[model samples]
Target: MVKKKPTNKDDNLVAQNRKARHDYRVLQTYEAGIALTGTEIKSVRASRVNLKDGFAQIRDGQATLMNVHISEYEQGNQFNHDPLRNRKLLLHKQEIKRLAKETDKKGVTIVPLKMYLKKGFAKVLIGVAEGKHEYDKRETMKKRDQEREISRVLKHY
Candidate 1:
């Protein structure tokens, strides 16, 4: 008899870029597999990953993730991988072309919203986003505050 693996959503989440939604208006999101070295995978599983300041790009018909940091494994000596190296994202050709087209627009770029492990493999949720102006950000904050106030009032009833 084989033991079944427990499925927990939060447990699988490795890292998230909290500021991604605040700074940019995400238009679309794509789930792409990431290619990580042995040590890098080990570091990711240990929750030593940072998605802040990370972005994705399509170049030469390939999707690449950049600026994401996966801390070096403490147990890994000379074979440890570089933390800041650009890692390839495994996406379909159609998806790559779509992302490339979307990024070609002004003020539009690709950002990594979060990184998680799925089926024991590292996956990144990348978004095509446009920069949010100061006023837009303020509006979003105002709306959120209003919603919170409404919920609080309802709960008191």
Candidate 2:
């Protein structure tokens, strides 16, 4: 039988913060629109962005994305955006209110897990996560290792 090698995501993936998944137990996920400048758009098209260490904050009934890194556009001199800027996250007032209410619970957070261009518009996938205890994290790792081991066995047999 012919076997096909496993493949990762396409190279067009802009940025991902894997740690967010490990450190927090994601309860729900939301796709949010981001406001970007021209230079920021160019930088995103080049895949020059980072979602690591990025998070969403709720303030004054609004949502803001903090610590997202968008590299400077090479062709745009003196008009590039700040690499790490707090940008507005576009969501309905009701959604924002819901997120804010949920986030008020201790140890629950708004984490930006991914950034990518979807259907010609930039989007951020934010996770509403609750902090995981050390034991929980270890259990997750153990389960992942078991899955990997099972996959390896199946591949060999």
Candidate 3:
């Protein structure tokens, strides 16, 4: 029996929204700090975050992350933060203002794409994305399939 070493370089990635790519055309991406309680931070460190339904919204000139589920910490008794609570995103005022202005345009919104820890600080990658239509999604799928087929043919040859 051979033992394997734990050498996952991308293990720091807490969560990713795979559907975001298929459903939206990303225009821009921004990294923002997340405000978390002690227990919430612990949960995030444990990779207990879900970005599938997460999104960012600007309100009163501030950005907030909503629908990001962070499971409760096991050791947390009564001090655990709410799993689905809206958490504030740390961004400069200028950036917030720009995001607010850009989000006002039709079909453009903020979506959380990935979450990870950078230098021990929890950070989220949010994107300004435009929603894709059904035909656009189909076209993307077709392109991906063609790429896969080409790779297979090359390998066989």
Query: Number of backbone collisions per candidate, in order?
Result: 0, 0, 0
The reply for model 1, stretches above 4 Å from the true place, is 1-9
Measured by TM-score, the strongest candidate is 1
lDDT of 3 by residue, 1-157 (tens): 9997674426678888999998999999999999999999999999999999888999998899999999999999999889999999999999999999899999999999999887788999899999999999999999999999999999999
Q: What is the TM-score of each candidate against the true structure?
A: 0.93, 0.86, 0.90
Q: Give candidate 3 misplaced runs (Cα > 4 Å).
A: 1-11
Give per-residue CA lDDT, model 2, range 59-124, as digits (tens). 998899998888889999988888898999999988999999999999999999888777678888
Worst 10 residues of 1 by lDDT: 4-13
Candidate 2's C-alpha runs over 4 A off are: 1-12, 151-157
Q: All candidates' lDDT scores?
A: 0.94, 0.88, 0.93
TM-score of model 1 vs. true structure: 0.93
All candidates in order of lDDT, best leading: 1, 3, 2
TM-score, candidate number 3: 0.90
